[model samples]
Target: MKPRISMITLGVANMAKAIDFYQNGLGFPRHGEGEQVAFFNLNGSWLGLYPKDALAEDAMVDSNASGFNAFSLAHNVGSEAEVEQVIQQAINAGATVTKTPRPTDWGGYSGYFKDPDGHLWEVAHNPHFWIGPEDTPK
Candidate 1:
Protein backbone atom coordinates (compact mmCIF):
# COMPACT_ATOMS: atom_id res chain seq x y z
CA MET A 1 0.00 0.00 0.00
CA LYS A 2 1.11 3.55 -0.65
CA PRO A 3 2.27 5.42 2.42
CA ARG A 4 0.27 8.56 1.88
CA ILE A 5 -2.78 10.14 3.38
CA SER A 6 -4.94 11.58 0.62
CA MET A 7 -7.35 13.16 3.03
CA ILE A 8 -8.53 13.35 6.63
CA THR A 9 -12.24 13.43 7.22
CA LEU A 10 -13.65 14.98 10.40
CA GLY A 11 -17.08 14.01 11.60
CA VAL A 12 -18.64 17.23 12.89
CA ALA A 13 -21.92 17.51 14.73
CA ASN A 14 -23.01 20.62 12.86
CA MET A 15 -22.24 20.61 9.18
CA ALA A 16 -22.96 24.26 8.50
CA LYS A 17 -21.23 25.42 11.65
CA ALA A 18 -18.25 23.25 10.81
CA ILE A 19 -18.15 24.64 7.33
CA ASP A 20 -18.18 28.17 8.67
CA PHE A 21 -15.48 27.41 11.18
CA TYR A 22 -13.15 25.84 8.64
CA GLN A 23 -13.94 27.87 5.57
CA ASN A 24 -14.65 31.33 6.90
CA GLY A 25 -13.01 31.32 10.31
CA LEU A 26 -9.91 29.28 9.69
CA GLY A 27 -9.55 30.45 6.08
CA PHE A 28 -9.49 26.94 4.65
CA PRO A 29 -10.21 26.96 0.95
CA ARG A 30 -13.53 25.32 0.22
CA HIS A 31 -13.41 22.75 -2.55
CA GLY A 32 -17.06 23.05 -3.44
CA GLU A 33 -20.16 24.91 -2.39
CA GLY A 34 -22.43 23.07 -0.03
CA GLU A 35 -23.62 22.74 3.55
CA GLN A 36 -23.89 18.95 3.50
CA VAL A 37 -20.12 18.43 3.35
CA ALA A 38 -16.92 20.41 2.97
CA PHE A 39 -13.41 19.79 1.60
CA PHE A 40 -10.32 21.90 1.95
CA ASN A 41 -7.08 21.55 0.07
CA LEU A 42 -4.05 21.25 2.27
CA ASN A 43 -0.36 21.50 1.40
CA GLY A 44 -0.05 17.81 0.55
CA SER A 45 -3.44 16.41 1.42
CA TRP A 46 -7.05 17.37 1.99
CA LEU A 47 -9.29 18.01 4.97
CA GLY A 48 -12.89 16.94 4.85
CA LEU A 49 -15.79 17.66 7.17
CA TYR A 50 -18.99 15.67 7.20
CA PRO A 51 -21.99 15.26 9.43
CA LYS A 52 -21.14 12.97 12.36
CA ASP A 53 -24.16 10.72 12.22
CA ALA A 54 -23.97 10.42 8.45
CA LEU A 55 -20.30 9.59 8.62
CA ALA A 56 -20.96 6.92 11.24
CA GLU A 57 -23.76 5.51 9.14
CA ASP A 58 -21.44 5.27 6.16
CA ALA A 59 -18.90 3.49 8.34
CA MET A 60 -21.60 1.20 9.73
CA VAL A 61 -20.99 2.28 13.32
CA ASP A 62 -22.97 3.88 16.12
CA SER A 63 -22.80 7.66 16.34
CA ASN A 64 -23.62 7.97 20.04
CA ALA A 65 -20.03 8.16 21.12
CA SER A 66 -18.28 11.18 22.65
CA GLY A 67 -15.02 12.32 24.29
CA PHE A 68 -11.51 11.69 23.11
CA ASN A 69 -10.98 9.37 20.14
CA ALA A 70 -7.32 8.62 20.90
CA PHE A 71 -6.22 10.47 17.76
CA SER A 72 -5.25 13.96 16.71
CA LEU A 73 -4.41 15.90 13.57
CA ALA A 74 -1.12 17.78 13.32
CA HIS A 75 0.02 20.83 11.39
CA ASN A 76 3.76 21.25 11.22
CA VAL A 77 5.21 24.64 10.44
CA GLY A 78 8.58 26.02 9.35
CA SER A 79 9.42 27.85 12.56
CA GLU A 80 8.60 27.96 16.24
CA ALA A 81 7.05 31.38 15.84
CA GLU A 82 4.75 29.98 13.22
CA VAL A 83 3.48 27.49 15.71
CA GLU A 84 2.32 30.25 18.03
CA GLN A 85 0.85 32.18 15.11
CA VAL A 86 -1.14 29.19 13.97
CA ILE A 87 -2.37 28.52 17.46
CA GLN A 88 -3.59 32.09 17.78
CA GLN A 89 -5.23 31.82 14.41
CA ALA A 90 -7.14 28.76 15.52
CA ILE A 91 -8.17 30.55 18.69
CA ASN A 92 -9.43 33.57 16.77
CA ALA A 93 -11.41 31.13 14.69
CA GLY A 94 -13.26 29.93 17.79
CA ALA A 95 -10.97 27.03 18.70
CA THR A 96 -9.93 26.51 22.28
CA VAL A 97 -6.29 26.28 23.17
CA THR A 98 -5.61 22.98 24.85
CA LYS A 99 -1.89 23.66 25.22
CA THR A 100 0.16 26.79 24.95
CA PRO A 101 3.14 26.74 22.64
CA ARG A 102 6.23 25.53 24.41
CA PRO A 103 9.48 23.68 23.95
CA THR A 104 9.17 19.92 23.62
CA ASP A 105 11.25 16.99 24.82
CA TRP A 106 12.18 16.25 21.23
CA GLY A 107 13.85 19.68 21.00
CA GLY A 108 10.94 21.12 19.09
CA TYR A 109 8.06 23.47 19.87
CA SER A 110 4.35 22.70 19.77
CA GLY A 111 0.89 23.41 21.04
CA TYR A 112 -2.65 22.07 20.80
CA PHE A 113 -6.12 23.35 20.05
CA LYS A 114 -9.62 21.93 19.89
CA ASP A 115 -11.80 22.95 17.03
CA PRO A 116 -15.45 23.77 17.41
CA ASP A 117 -16.26 20.12 16.92
CA GLY A 118 -13.81 19.19 19.67
CA HIS A 119 -11.29 17.68 17.25
CA LEU A 120 -7.76 17.97 18.51
CA TRP A 121 -5.07 19.59 16.36
CA GLU A 122 -1.42 19.92 17.22
CA VAL A 123 0.58 22.76 15.71
CA ALA A 124 4.30 22.19 15.85
CA HIS A 125 7.68 23.22 14.57
CA ASN A 126 10.25 20.42 14.37
CA PRO A 127 13.71 21.79 13.84
CA HIS A 128 15.01 18.38 12.74
CA PHE A 129 12.36 17.97 10.09
CA TRP A 130 11.95 19.74 6.78
CA ILE A 131 8.39 20.93 6.34
CA GLY A 132 8.25 21.90 2.68
CA PRO A 133 8.65 20.28 -0.74
CA GLU A 134 11.86 18.56 -1.90
CA ASP A 135 12.77 18.03 1.76
CA THR A 136 14.29 21.47 1.84
CA PRO A 137 15.01 22.88 5.28
CA LYS A 138 12.79 25.80 6.09
Candidate 2:
Protein backbone atom coordinates (compact mmCIF):
# COMPACT_ATOMS: atom_id res chain seq x y z
CA MET A 1 0.00 0.00 0.00
CA LYS A 2 1.17 3.51 -0.62
CA PRO A 3 1.96 5.53 2.48
CA ARG A 4 0.49 8.77 1.37
CA ILE A 5 -2.43 10.89 2.56
CA SER A 6 -4.30 12.68 -0.16
CA MET A 7 -6.75 14.14 2.32
CA ILE A 8 -7.32 14.57 6.05
CA THR A 9 -10.92 14.79 7.10
CA LEU A 10 -12.06 16.21 10.41
CA GLY A 11 -15.40 15.41 11.94
CA VAL A 12 -17.00 18.64 12.99
CA ALA A 13 -20.12 19.41 15.00
CA ASN A 14 -21.72 21.71 12.49
CA MET A 15 -21.00 21.69 8.79
CA ALA A 16 -21.85 25.33 8.20
CA LYS A 17 -20.02 26.45 11.32
CA ALA A 18 -16.97 24.45 10.33
CA ILE A 19 -17.16 25.88 6.86
CA ASP A 20 -17.25 29.40 8.25
CA PHE A 21 -14.34 28.60 10.51
CA TYR A 22 -12.07 27.14 7.84
CA GLN A 23 -13.22 29.03 4.78
CA ASN A 24 -14.16 32.51 6.05
CA GLY A 25 -12.10 32.55 9.23
CA LEU A 26 -8.74 31.19 8.15
CA GLY A 27 -9.04 31.62 4.41
CA PHE A 28 -8.32 28.10 3.25
CA PRO A 29 -9.23 27.83 -0.40
CA ARG A 30 -12.53 25.97 -0.71
CA HIS A 31 -11.90 23.70 -3.62
CA GLY A 32 -15.13 21.73 -3.32
CA GLU A 33 -18.06 21.90 -0.95
CA GLY A 34 -21.40 20.25 -0.36
CA GLU A 35 -24.15 20.14 2.21
CA GLN A 36 -22.35 17.51 4.27
CA VAL A 37 -18.67 18.19 3.62
CA ALA A 38 -16.17 20.83 2.60
CA PHE A 39 -12.70 20.58 1.12
CA PHE A 40 -9.68 22.84 1.32
CA ASN A 41 -6.65 22.94 -0.89
CA LEU A 42 -3.60 22.72 1.26
CA ASN A 43 -0.07 23.24 0.01
CA GLY A 44 0.44 19.57 -0.81
CA SER A 45 -2.55 17.90 0.72
CA TRP A 46 -6.26 18.37 1.13
CA LEU A 47 -8.15 19.19 4.32
CA GLY A 48 -11.77 18.26 4.75
CA LEU A 49 -14.50 18.86 7.30
CA TYR A 50 -17.61 16.80 7.77
CA PRO A 51 -20.43 16.36 10.21
CA LYS A 52 -19.14 14.71 13.37
CA ASP A 53 -22.08 12.44 13.98
CA ALA A 54 -22.05 11.30 10.38
CA LEU A 55 -18.38 10.52 10.62
CA ALA A 56 -18.92 8.50 13.76
CA GLU A 57 -21.74 6.60 12.18
CA ASP A 58 -19.68 5.92 9.08
CA ALA A 59 -16.89 4.60 11.28
CA MET A 60 -19.45 2.40 13.02
CA VAL A 61 -18.97 4.03 16.39
CA ASP A 62 -21.25 5.73 18.88
CA SER A 63 -21.70 9.41 18.03
CA ASN A 64 -22.26 10.76 21.52
CA ALA A 65 -18.76 10.71 23.00
CA SER A 66 -16.19 13.47 22.80
CA GLY A 67 -12.95 14.44 24.51
CA PHE A 68 -9.36 15.03 23.63
CA ASN A 69 -8.48 13.21 20.42
CA ALA A 70 -4.77 13.86 21.08
CA PHE A 71 -3.74 15.26 17.74
CA SER A 72 -3.76 18.43 15.66
CA LEU A 73 -3.44 19.12 11.96
CA ALA A 74 -0.58 21.37 10.87
CA HIS A 75 0.41 23.29 7.80
CA ASN A 76 3.95 24.19 6.78
CA VAL A 77 4.45 27.07 4.44
CA GLY A 78 7.33 28.51 2.43
CA SER A 79 7.28 32.10 3.70
CA GLU A 80 5.99 34.41 6.42
CA ALA A 81 3.40 35.74 4.02
CA GLU A 82 1.93 32.30 3.53
CA VAL A 83 1.81 31.65 7.25
CA GLU A 84 0.29 35.00 8.12
CA GLN A 85 -2.18 34.82 5.31
CA VAL A 86 -3.38 31.40 6.36
CA ILE A 87 -3.61 32.34 10.02
CA GLN A 88 -5.54 35.51 9.34
CA GLN A 89 -7.70 33.77 6.82
CA ALA A 90 -8.60 31.17 9.38
CA ILE A 91 -9.46 33.89 11.84
CA ASN A 92 -11.72 35.59 9.33
CA ALA A 93 -13.30 32.29 8.43
CA GLY A 94 -14.61 32.02 12.02
CA ALA A 95 -11.94 29.82 13.53
CA THR A 96 -11.48 30.60 17.18
CA VAL A 97 -8.07 32.17 16.93
CA THR A 98 -6.06 30.24 19.49
CA LYS A 99 -2.79 32.07 19.04
CA THR A 100 -1.72 34.95 16.93
CA PRO A 101 1.19 34.61 14.56
CA ARG A 102 4.57 35.21 16.13
CA PRO A 103 8.25 34.33 15.93
CA THR A 104 9.19 30.95 17.24
CA ASP A 105 12.28 29.83 19.17
CA TRP A 106 13.01 27.41 16.36
CA GLY A 107 13.68 30.36 14.04
CA GLY A 108 10.30 30.11 12.40
CA TYR A 109 6.97 31.90 12.38
CA SER A 110 3.86 30.08 13.54
CA GLY A 111 0.48 30.20 15.22
CA TYR A 112 -2.38 27.96 16.26
CA PHE A 113 -6.15 28.05 16.06
CA LYS A 114 -9.15 25.85 16.62
CA ASP A 115 -12.06 25.23 14.36
CA PRO A 116 -15.68 25.57 15.49
CA ASP A 117 -15.56 21.97 16.65
CA GLY A 118 -12.45 22.55 18.76
CA HIS A 119 -10.14 20.84 16.29
CA LEU A 120 -6.74 22.50 16.42
CA TRP A 121 -4.73 23.57 13.44
CA GLU A 122 -1.30 25.11 13.13
CA VAL A 123 0.11 27.26 10.39
CA ALA A 124 3.85 27.67 10.24
CA HIS A 125 6.79 28.46 8.05
CA ASN A 126 9.71 26.08 8.38
CA PRO A 127 12.86 26.81 6.44
CA HIS A 128 14.27 23.31 6.76
CA PHE A 129 11.61 21.55 4.71
CA TRP A 130 10.43 21.67 1.15
CA ILE A 131 7.10 20.87 -0.55
CA GLY A 132 7.57 19.19 -3.89
CA PRO A 133 5.17 18.48 -6.72
CA GLU A 134 4.63 14.93 -5.49
CA ASP A 135 3.32 16.18 -2.12
CA THR A 136 5.19 13.79 0.17
CA PRO A 137 5.28 14.43 3.90
CA LYS A 138 8.56 14.30 5.79
Best by TM-score: 1
Candidate 2 lDDT score at position 28: 71
Number of backbone collisions per candidate: 0, 13
**Candidate 1, 46-106: lDDT as tens digits:** 9999899999999999999987999999888899999989999898889999999999999
**RMSD list, candidates in order:** 2.0, 3.1
What is the lDDT of every predicted structure here?
A: 0.91, 0.80
Model 1: CA > 4 A from native: 134-138
If scored against the real structure, what TM-score would every candidate get?
0.94, 0.78
TM-score of 1: 0.94
How displaced is residue 129 in candidate 2, in Å? 1.1
Looking at candidate 2, what is the lDDT of residue 23? 73
What would the per-residue lDDT of candidate 2 be over residues 45-123, giving only the tens digit for each residue?
Answer: 8988878888888899888877877888888788889888887777667677778888899888889988778888888
Which candidate number would show the highest lDDT if scored against the true structure?
1
